[model samples]
Target: MKVAVLYEINKPLVIEEVTLPPLKYGQVLVKLKTSGLCHKQLEEMTGKRGHDPFLPHLLGHEGAGIVKDIGPGVSFVNKGDHVVLGWMKGKGINSEPPEYTNGRNKLNAGWITTFNEYGIYSENRVTSIKKEMPFDVACLLGCAVTTGYGVVNRIAKMESRKKVAVFGIGGIGLNVVQWASVRGATHVIAVDLRNDKLELARRIGATHVINAGNEHAVDAVRTITDGGADYVFEAAGNIHVMEQAYEATNGKGLTVLMGVPKKEDKLCIDPIPLYLGRRITGCHGGDTVKDEDIPLAVDLYLQGKLKLNELITERIHLSGINEAFQRMKEGKIVGRSIIEFERSSPD
Candidate 1:
């Protein structure tokens, strides 16, 4: 199989043909149809979280594919089933991460990876959805849509008419704003420095939009919410934005951190807000229980409720991945981009 290998941090991934080992217990082999390009992968690629001992590893975590084969212990999915591959654990068996090789050098991969023609993923990381679901958009359910839905439903438990301020309208942030609206938040505010993203957010159901580039996000949010928002989500992964999100939360509201910050980065906050009933915390994939939540997200999409189609701003071949990353760094991607492998026809 041909896979993009991360040889070093802040370096272009080397596309190489490597031998995929036979599936082990609790593992399954999948022929990837599409993969979602996530900022989390960008963080990993740039070594944002610090030293990576797992160099020369596979590069993606969210994808949709077909079950080409199943190992001995696999039971949830059968051959030819359509499934979503995600980093979060689901109902199946949890096997060890897979390893591939070029006959000389060993390559590492996590439980799930999709930036390749084929992948050997743990059964627990694969969830079978309807066979007819489109692979390209279904890829979003693996992370973006699921995380945002989980954030609104599970983490914040945000009720209708609550004020919500999402501090980044990218893939996850856009979903957060969309779900916030779907959940009936009367004052759903989308915050970003980019006008295109803010405009997209409005179409996605944000009652208000704030450009932090020109004005103060905290002040804008406060003014819109009449003091502060009930829920403030920091999805931009910026420490300064996180602090602002914290400051923008109502005295008795919840602030959820949806973006992954640098490992050495820290944010200062006053505990007095907590004393007054304010709560601040972080999210792990929006605390999504994939087995239950993924299906729900899929249902919403199938019912023409979730805006999965609009989230895909670009569809690039795997060879153009580095350029995609550059676009992401420049904030050129409005929502999310998908790596459509069919066009590449990798060996």
Candidate 2:
């Protein structure tokens, strides 16, 4: 199978033929249909974040495909079922004793992301693919969409009539805007520097849009929501924007940091404001439980509450991934750039 291999940090991904190991217990083999490019992939590729930093590593995490083979003891899905890949591919966390809360187990600690094509980004992928929806859309449930939704629904505890502002109307941020709207936010403000993204945000459900380039984003958000929003989400991963998000919140409001920032970077905030009930929180993978959240996200997509199709801006072949990454860096694309793999015809 042909998979894009990351040989080193800040280097181009090399598409090469590689061998895939047979499926292990509790795993399945998927013939990938499409996978999305996430900012996390770029971060991992550039060594901005400490991940699988070694060379010759597969590097995709948002994937969806058809089930071609199944490993022993797995029965949740069957062969030929259309499914989306879960982000954490490793074993789920054991929900017992100190882990379980209110009669529910905690999320799993799986490592099955969609970065690898076969292993992470190959023509063939090895993992458990849960069958339910179209592979292309399902792939997004693995990461971008899930992350945004998880932040809003799970982390922030958003309620009706709250004023919400989502910074960075890109892939994950866009989802944040729509989810905020769907969850009954009275004033949903979408903030971005790009007009195209802001327009897309309104189309999805943002009641108001702010171009951070035109005015001070913090001021704009404060004016729109009348002194600040109830919840401010920092999804751009930019330190400056993150600080602005903190400042744009109402006194005692909550700010959720969803973007992955540089390890060494830091943001300065007024300690006094926090004492007045202001809360700042950081989350990982949107605090999602894949087994439960993935299905719920899928159902939302089917119900027209979640906008998945509109989030996909580009679809390219497996070989075109490098160019896709280049476009992403240039901010030439919005939402997600998905890679569609063509299956090899039988001889």
Candidate 3:
């Protein structure tokens, strides 16, 4: 199979053909139909979290594919089943990470990898979805949509008519906006440096949009919500933006940090807020339960209640991944960039 290999940090991935070892216990072989390039992968590519012991490893966690084969002890899915592969664990066996070879050297991969034509994922990393669900959009359920949904419904337990503000209107952020709207939030404020993203957010559900590059984000959010938003989400993966999200919350509001900051970065906030009932917390993949959230998102999308298609702004082949990464880094991509594999057909 041809896979994108990250041999070094801050370097472009090398696309090459590699050989996959036979599947072990609780592993599943999948032929990828589509994959979503997430910001998490960009962090890995740039070494945002510091030294990577898994260099020369496969890159990608969210994808939709058909199960080509299943190893022993697997019961969650079977051969020919449509599945969404994600980083989060679900109900199944947690197999060992797979390793591929280029006939000379070995390459490492995590429990879930999608930047390849085919992948060997742990059973717990994949969940079967309806065949009717489009692969391009279903791939998003593997992370972005599921995480955003979890953030709103699970972690925050957001109530109706509450004022909400989301910082960084990217893939995950956009979903946060949509879910916030769907949950009946009276005011959904979208904040970002890119006007295009702000516009996209408006189209989805943001009652107001603020360009952080122009005016002060915290002040604008406070002004819009008449003192501050009830819930603030930081998804820009920048420490400064996370701070701004915290400041934009009301006296009794909760600030949720969804972005992954650099390893050396430390967040400093006023401790007085905690004493006054104001709170700040970070989310791990939105506290999403993969087995539950993925299926629910699929049902919502199929029912025309969830906005998945709008989240997909661009679809590129595997070869164009680097270019897509550049666009995402520059904030040129208003939404998710899906990698459409050549052999997308389930057959």
Candidate 4:
């Protein structure tokens, strides 16, 4: 199989052929069909999170694939079953990660790396999907869509007609806006630095859009919400924007943090807000129970309640992964960008 390996920080991934290791207990070998390009991977590659103990390793946390074979003790998924690969642990066995060597040195990988054409992942990282969903769209069920929808459904627990402000309208933030719209939020304010994103947010569900580059995001959100929003979600991994997102929340409202920050990153906030009833919480994978939630998200999409198809802004082959990351870094993509592995043959 061919996989993208990160040998150093701030370097293009090395796409090379590798031999798959023997599958261990509770592991499943998957032929990846598609994978999502996420900001978290970009952060890891650029050293934003700092330090690389796993220097030469495979990266990518979310994907869609078929179950090529099952190892000992694997049961939930069978060979030929369509599945979604995610970083979050779900039901089933959590197997040890696989090791891939290039005959000289060994390369490291997590239990759920999907940058490769094929992978041996822990059973818990693979969720079986029975619906006839496109591989590219299904790949998003692994992270981008799930995280956004999970943030609203599982964390924010938004009430109908509530005022909402979503900071940074990327894949995750855009989903927050979409779900808020479906949940009937009276005012869904989408804040971002890009006009393209703001416009898309408006089309998806944002009742109001603010380009942070042109005006004060907090002030604009406050104006739209009539003072402050009842719920605010920060998906942009910017400390300044995170602070502003908190500021845009009402005194009695809730603020959810969906962005992963650097190890040295810190939030500055006044203690008086907490004492006055304002609450803040951090979300990991939107606190989603992946095994259960992935199916629910699929059902919503099938029922015409969710817009999964519209979330993918572009699709490219594995060879174009670096350019895709560059587009994400420049904030040029309006939604999720996916890697269509099926477009190329295995090495």
Candidate 5:
């Protein structure tokens, strides 16, 4: 199979043909149809989240595909089953990570990887979805959509008519806006430096938007909320923006940190806010239970209650992966960038 290999940090991924090892127990072989590019992958590429111990490894965590085969002890899905592959664990065996080999060297891969024509995913990382779900949109269910909705519904437990602010209107942030609006938040304020993203956010239920590049984000959010929003979500993966998101929240409201910052970066905030009922917490893939959440998310999309197609701003092939990352870095993509795969023989 052809896969993108990250041989070193702060370098472009090398696309090469690799030989896949046999599927181990609880693993499933999948022919990927679509893969969603995420900021997390960019973080890993740039070493923004710190050391890269797993160099020369496969990249990507969110994808949709058809089950081509399953290894021993796997029961959650079957051959021909349409599934969403994610990083979050669901209800299956936690299999060992797969190893792939180029002609001369070994390459590493996690339980879930999608930046390839084919992938061997752990049972817990694959969730079977309806055959009718579009691969491009369904792939987003693997992380972006599930994580965004989870942050609002599961993590924050945001109530109706509450004020909400989301910093960074990328894929995850865009979902946060839509979900917050769905939850009946009176004010869904989207903040970002990119006007395109901010505009897309407004189209997808963001009641207002603030271009942080133009105006002060925290002050603008506070002003729009008539003080501070009841809930604030930071998805920019920047330490400074995280601080701003925290400061933009109401004294008694919650601040959910959805972005992963550099490993060495430390967040500084006033301790006095804690004493006054202000709460802050970090999110892990939106606290999503993939088995439960993926299906429900698909149902919502099928019912037209969710906006999946709108989140897709660009689509490209695996060969264009590096340029996709460049666009992400330049803030050129308004929402999600999907990597559509062509069917290939799993040699």
Candidate 6:
């Protein structure tokens, strides 16, 4: 199979032919149809996220594909089923409960993330896709969409008539805006440096848009929501934006940090506000329970209530993966950019 290999930090991924290992117990081999480019891939390429994985490792995280084969003991899905690559691989209902914890009981299951081609991104990756969806849409259900929806519905627990603010009007942020609006937020503020993105944010559901570059984001969000928003979500990984998100919330408002920040990056804030009942929480994979959420998102998409089509900005061939990353770095694309694969062999 042909996979895009990351040869070195700060270098372009090299596409190379490689042999895939046979599926193991409880694993399903999926013939990938589409994969989305995410900022984490960029961070991995530049070593911003820390040590690199194995040299020449396949690069891709968000993906969707068709099941080609199933290994022993796998019965969640069957061959020929269409599915999205899930990020939390090992941390599902089948996982084991943790033996020990600080105080509260917790599961020891490992998170399922799609970072490698077969692991997370590739023509054929390990997955258990449902039979009822398109590969392209299913792939997004793995990360971007799920993450955004998770922040709004799970972390913030947004309620009707509440004021909400979403910083960074990119893929995840746009979903946050739409979900908040759908939840009946009376005032939804979208903040971004780009006018084009702000426009898209409004079209999706933002009651107001703030150009973070032209005006102070914290002040702008405050102005829109009176004193402060009931909930604020920071989807941009930048530290400055994270601080702005914190400032945009009221004294007791909830701030959800959904973006993955660089390793070793520290956030500095006063102790007083934190003591004032304000809450800052972090979420992983949108706290998604795949068995529950993925199907719900799929149903929402099928109902036309969620705007999956509008989220997709472009579709490129698998060979165009590098170009897609370049465009993403240049901030020339919006929402999501997918790599659609064309089969080279029937087998």
lDDT of 1 by residue, 162-182 (tens): 999999887889999999988
Task: Tell me the tens digit of each residue's lDDT in model 4 across 169-203.
Answer: 87789989998998899999999888888888887
Question: Which lDDT values do the candidates have, in the order given?
Answer: 0.90, 0.73, 0.91, 0.88, 0.90, 0.71
lDDT of 2 by residue, 167-215 (tens): 9887778988988988999999999889999988988899999988898
lDDT string, candidate 6, 217-323, tens digits: 89878888888998999988888888889888899899998777877889987658889888888776577566566778888778777767667778877677778
lDDT for each residue of candidate 5 in 1-347, tens digit (9 for 90 to 100) = 88999998888999999987898999999999999999889989999867888888999989999999999999889999999999898899999989899979889998888899999988999999998898989999988889888889999999999999999887788999999998999999999888888889988899999989999989898888988999999998899999999999998999999887878999989879989999999986778777888899899889988888988988888989999999999878778889988734211
Give residue 224's error in model 2 in angstroms: 1.2
Q: Candidate 3 residues 1-347, lDDT tens each?
A: 88899998888889899987899999999999999999889989998767899778998989999999999999999999999999998899999989898887789998989999999999999899999999989999988888899999999999999999999987789999999998999999999888888998998899999998899999999999999999999998999999999999999999999888888999988889889999998887788988988988888889988878888888888888888898878877778889999844421
Mark the regions of model 6 whose C-alpha exceeds 4 Å error after superposition: 90-132, 260-276, 343-347
**Which scores better on TM-score, 4 or 6?**
4
- The CA lDDT at 122 in model 1 is 91
TM-score of 4: 0.92
- Residue 315, model 1: Cα distance from true site in angstroms: 0.5
Residue 262 deviation, candidate 1, in Å? 4.8
Once superposed on the true structure, which residue ranges of model 4 sit more than 4 Å away at CA? 260-276, 344-347
What lDDT, from 0 to 1, does candidate 6 have?
0.71
Candidate 3 to truth, TM: 0.92
Return the TM-score for each candidate structure.
0.92, 0.84, 0.92, 0.92, 0.91, 0.83
